[model samples]
Target: MKAAAYRLTKIKGKGMGLVAARDLKQGSLVVSELPVLFIPGKSNDLLVQEEFAKLHPKKQRQMMELFDVNSTHGGAKTPEGVFITNAYRCPLGNALFPTAARINHSCAPNLTMTHREDTQGRAMIRTACDVREGQELTLCYTDPWLCRQERHEYLERMYDFTCKCSTCSLTGEAMRESERRRERAAVLRVKVAQNLAMCLEHSTPEDLLTEVEEALDIARTELFCEPTIPLMSERAMVLALLCKKPELAQKYADETVRVRLVTEGGHKGLERFRQYAKCPSSHPGAMALGVGSLPAESPDLSAAGRVVPPCYSPMSVVPIEGKGMGVVATRHIIRGELILDEAPLLSLTQLDANLIGGSGASIGSLLLDKLQRISPAQRAAFWQLRETSDSDVGSAARASSIFMCNSTTGADDRMHVYLFGCRFRHNCVPNVLGLDTLSKKNHMRYRAMRDIEEGEEMTVAYVIDDHNFTMGKEELDTLLEQRRVSSCDCELCSLTGPALARSRRRRKKMQALYDESKNYYQPGQLPKLKELISLIEEDIQSPFLVADIHTMALFTALEDEPRSDAAGYHALEALKCKMLSEGDHMGLEQAKAWAERPALARGEKGSTCEYYKPLEFPYVDRDPDMPFAVALRQHEEDVQRQAEEAQQKKAAKKARSKSKKGGQKKKNKGRRH
Candidate 1:
């Protein structure tokens, strides 16, 4: 009995089209009507004719009144032609909806259609986003991930006209960029499918999580909302079942349901997602994965608020003397306390170099394209960030520079620019431990490395590696210079006299021991590994490196005859270190499992533990005292020397051949005389 939200109208060049009857908010229902005639299986002339004859006389007339492009475009006025022109695919089969058939196609559509079985097999159309009055309602007819050319070809072949939708009407570089994004999206779609399949078999949960997060990033960037619903659902399932993080699982499930409601009114899986959101352990997959019915509670941050804004709350964005702006603690914060957890404003995955530059696409061009597509608020937030580039550069170049200066590698290995997270100033030795939380949540989490008082500025290491801990002050400065960092005034960087020398000596020894541990295990390596742990703990308070050292110690302990008690101890230490480095999750779970059961340390293949193995470090034989840049230049010189030597040999061989030939000619002339 409710009035229709849209009225049929003559669209300028597109014949009949649906236009909004009034201003409609997102998710508002535009049409819900049962089919006038429903045909089962693949529709053909005979099938359509049979279905049409079965329809009531009034219904038949109504269906016939609907626009038939096949007949109007010089094609035979057959019943099947009209059926193909106006029919919408339903759960049972192809169904002809008189009202819904009038909707036009747009590459960037504001409306979405779904078949609703709950409403007695009625076709439902809803606004994907807000629509103003008199706005033409449209839905994408072909695959949304298809490139513009492919889309146009399909539309022209299937329908009788070429699509001139707003997206298709784009010209020049803008159009090429759009096409590239679509092609990339399509490739990523296939990758996601393959990864999901692999996850069900040989792939680790972490690998699948990374792939899903990357796919979701592209989907969000491209405004491909429908694909995200399924991705979020999968993410929730994986977090709950495999990862055993119920709280995160619930969060994703809730998000999935919200997105589903907004995009497609509701899917059949809507109720299931709601259940998962309410109780993640209720899912059958959780039981199979041995996940217990744990309460879905967020990680306790104690006094820290669950969510803090970028501007203020737990931390205040304040002006530092040298640094333009930096985050400062507003209150006393305890060690391991969560300081801030924020999502990225912009994210980009690592594309192949060929793909990045093949089609005249650079990071700057891609960034500019992304900027233009983002919401006004997001764009404003991005622009508000510090721009270290020259002010006179073009917008694309400017965006690229801003991104380069502030972006950090996320847990998924994608580059992300966080509005608030990037505000924390960089220090060689920092007071805060910032990590991209290792989940599909894609949050940059900043935790306190040590307790701090109110008004203290929060700082994090811009880059963390063996170099940060092992390199001396001068070497550190050289490395930072290479990275384009201005300077560091952190406590360690400011050390003078004996304090500085001792720190350097300790780090040098640590680096030596670390490199030794990476090679084939030696007879007396256990003591050296223990020393490395002590050095790391004393000199640098980084739990990640500490965890790495502990893992090495565990490996050494496992190699011993009958595996000593030290193996279990080191396992426990590794677990504690991992917990500090990367909150409670699957990494902690594996470490706990190893710690609880030392027998598992022997590992199935007898080489190393099956659950955990240290990553291999490629050996680069360079002098310990040499700066990286100097070593690089020396390498280039060595390469040039080899090239020159090869050239000299070739020239000498040619000269000897010429001399021999001249001598042979002289001998022949002398003989003739």
Candidate 2:
């Protein structure tokens, strides 16, 4: 059964895959193998150059010792071209063995990936999913970040094949819809970033506490649009810590860490998140400490390498040279195996220089240069580890830009990323879930919708809610063009005129409603709150709703139980759920957060003064369409009636006083006469 790793067979152009040569059970072991290659991205570039130059003097000997690297992407019959055409490129100079590289390409896939260290102190891969016999195993051909054309091109140019995957099949309006979703996601990300920057900039510990109490509304709002994206929730927790609410920060941090670990496989990038969960105030990148002082931990990548096993595979969304890149199984992978161990090619510090070129040129080259410009010792050390730029200036810049754009670490300060997994192609719906395991413990796993056969393509979603809401055509065209894709075929690429019109109208209405609800919510009307709820419900069906369901739930609960700790905590779910039907971010921590504060009454009888200050921007008024206005009116009437009653009571007292005074004066005058 252990040798069943040989069960992977060939299907010609379909590439090598796992076949259910027989039936398999749950928790069964699939193919697993130790990786044939190892590449650590650690170096300032000088080091790689120094090492490489060492052999330059012995060209013949060096060529024989090192595997041939083919830069030519074409039809040359030269030995280098054939191998270059065949060599499966991975992180740094690492390449996968032919056993794993022979797999075919697919947009939809069956298996998931996970990696850990075995008793030998070496990283190992094990099955996280069940596989059946005779199923063709395939890997993703493009990174999730690439647009459709980029993916198609990558496969064709490098792998010499064109993709007929589901994502590639979608054309016209459907593609646009997918792009719209991506764009909306990007926009929401910006908004979240903006809010985080603001909080980190102005808010002090006291300010953080109060703002945390309030800004959670926005965090919850953004969660609806992208629940799995942990940045928003992480920021919200950061706010809590700023105000010395360690427990609240710890709670939210736990969630942020969990999501980062599960999806990203616990690389260093997720370590701070893990720490933040355990010790929110102390974790690096804790905004409460001032985003400046709290720094993200970045390690030098030179001379560091993680040995992967054959069973682990990678899924990607990044573009490759020529034919964009995609995910590929690194070995006859078990359900879980070490697909790829990777470190950041370049890490930008929090210093101002990091902002140079806007990540425009090859950051790998730029960074290496910076290291060289430092003191002689530092430059020499950097030079010793660095490798020359293999790409032209534009490509170098693009590569640098790509790295910077996609290089984000979770709350966990450690920088982490899987080389192979980073190559999985993009789709609105992904089958694999990334687990962050590098710095902290990662739980990378893949579940099969059904029995997976050998050589079958395994895929995970790049974006969520692909089935219902997709991107707009303009978005698709714009992004694809920028990424150098000919066009797009995502579900939302093209649409009928009516459908497009409807989509626009829905987006407009949702924005309008969101504004109205935000404004109307100021007085904290309880009964009238149902109006905002209804409006949100109506807007939920729209394709362009920027925030996610979790965000909506958090905001709703905040309104429902203002000044109450119970409700707020219930809605701060930072996890990325695969099942889209989730209504809200409900859980234990949220409940605790809400429970801690207890509820406070808004106003009482004869409470005529407006003691509450209106919230700042992005915390808009409540929906005008809701019953809030009428409820506010009713509350006002009740207050007015109480005022009248108080007035009458005071008038009676005044009259009695005047009468007593008059009687006393008359008696005195009579006595005097």
Candidate 3:
């Protein structure tokens, strides 16, 4: 509504945010506002500078004042860095509603964003996930190339602050792992094209027997690693290039053409592919092998660990008050499961991120209304969930569906871009499970853990901070001092001051270990023997000790002695066994040096540290401090080892006696006894 209570406000660690004036519950619709303004870049070259100049000076000043200028990198104008190097954005786009903007920028964002377009050509901003009234709403800008150093510099410049986001908070091995993923992404693009082609070209009827079998492996690998929307377009291209079947290739090519027209508009870089997208059947690259009529592969949803469950989604034919009309969930859900699957009240490509700001840009929001208007068949599900607001009906009706029912992010996000069922934000330690919906209209289905305590605020984690995803003491401290806002004073951090003090100590100690381990690991090299020890220690002590413990062990081992130590041997053993079991080639190569240790020196199968199953003894509940599980496991191992040693000694003695008797037998035979 236009009321002051629903107004957007500035958040500190979180960035420009929205605060709830009145107490709210899990599924309550908090606020809906028309974007203060939307500056269509097509109309103005210097959209930001000129748009501000046109605004009332007071409002202009307010907008300018909110500029997170430090987002620029060395004054570079990359859209992403310029948006928010710190915790904010360039403040120019039309946001039908942006409660999510208040959250700070993090490479690893918990919240998501989506744009909902309705049948009447209207558009709305939506949360892909839930948010709390007081909690800072965070959304990843989802821009590639925003690596650690660049983000830090951008934040330092524009927001006049440093980022303490989890991505930036990694230390030692964690930092290196992050670097690996980023670098690997940069190099893997060309490899993907070649690899896909290799599969198609290298195979013959004598080799693989069929086209589908030949291309399946390549498709599997490429899809697994960062299959953004652009890649999906690329996949369509690959299909046309590599497939033997003309009809199948043409079908995918049509999608590529459609997506390209909607997103990139055949711009300079994209213009090159224009011919291929359109000329699918006759493209120069179409398989000349005459291999058409091969069997087609079924949609391998589970190939990439993705589940594409069948949809029994019900639709609504009513107007959702703020976000237009939609259906809401009537059932509870678990992570990675379907909550809703509806055809968009509307669907098109201009809604894509690339299309939104570039030429034909207005096309993105121009026809939103054409998509969302519903049909009569859904009148049942439609009427079932539509809600109206009394406070300001006009503004509510005009609000963006994404902001009202979903979250906003980039054009191509699978994890963060929510549909209708994203209004309910959870506490860090939540009691309710948030379900996934695949349409513009969905609902928050809250199921009780026990009996619902009538007024309980059902919530889920805004950021999953459990598993203590930290690297070192400094990193832990940095995050601990971050925006850890919580309403629950009953938890450890809020309840006892001394508990926090002890935690800081543990964190510091753990950090010391990480730093030491990082020094041992070589960039792109197989981790040194020392490095293996470090990762294992961190893995073990993580969550159980201060955040820094594991990394600290690795770091110390790396510097103290890279060659050999019992702990180093064991760490290498334990980690390698895990990696090999999990099929991690990189890990095996890195930990190779320590891998040569005696099998007994390495970890045992039934070790106490293995918490793979529920145990009965040393009851973790009765005495949390005592690691009876470990002690008992080790004791059992020691006993077994001793018994084996005794048997070996006895066998050796008997063998020696037999050999002596054989030597004497020759003398006795010669003598005649």
Q: What is the C-alpha lDDT of each candidate?
A: 0.66, 0.40, 0.37
Ranking by TM-score: 1, 2, 3
Candidate 3 lDDT by residue in tens digits, 503-552: 55654554454454454333322333334335434432212222223333
Q: Tell me the RMSD of model 3 versus the true structure.
A: 32.1
Superposed on all Cα atoms, the candidates' RMSDs to the truth, in angstroms, are 29.3, 33.5, 32.1
Best by TM-score: 1
TM-score of each: 0.42, 0.30, 0.27
Q: Which stretches of candidate 2 lie over 4 Å from their true place?
A: 1-6, 11-13, 19-83, 86-92, 108-138, 171-174, 183-275, 279-281, 287-673
User: Of 1 and 3, which scores higher on lDDT?
Assistant: 1
Residue pairs that clash (backbone atoms under 3 angstroms), model 1: none
Better of 2 and 3 by lDDT: 2
Evaluation by TM-score, superior candidate among 2 and 3: 2
In terms of lDDT, the poorest run of 10 residues in model 1 is 294-303
CA deviation > 4 Å runs, candidate 3: 1-50, 53-65, 68-101, 113-135, 141-146, 189-673
Scored by lDDT, the top model is 1
lDDT of 2 at 302: 16
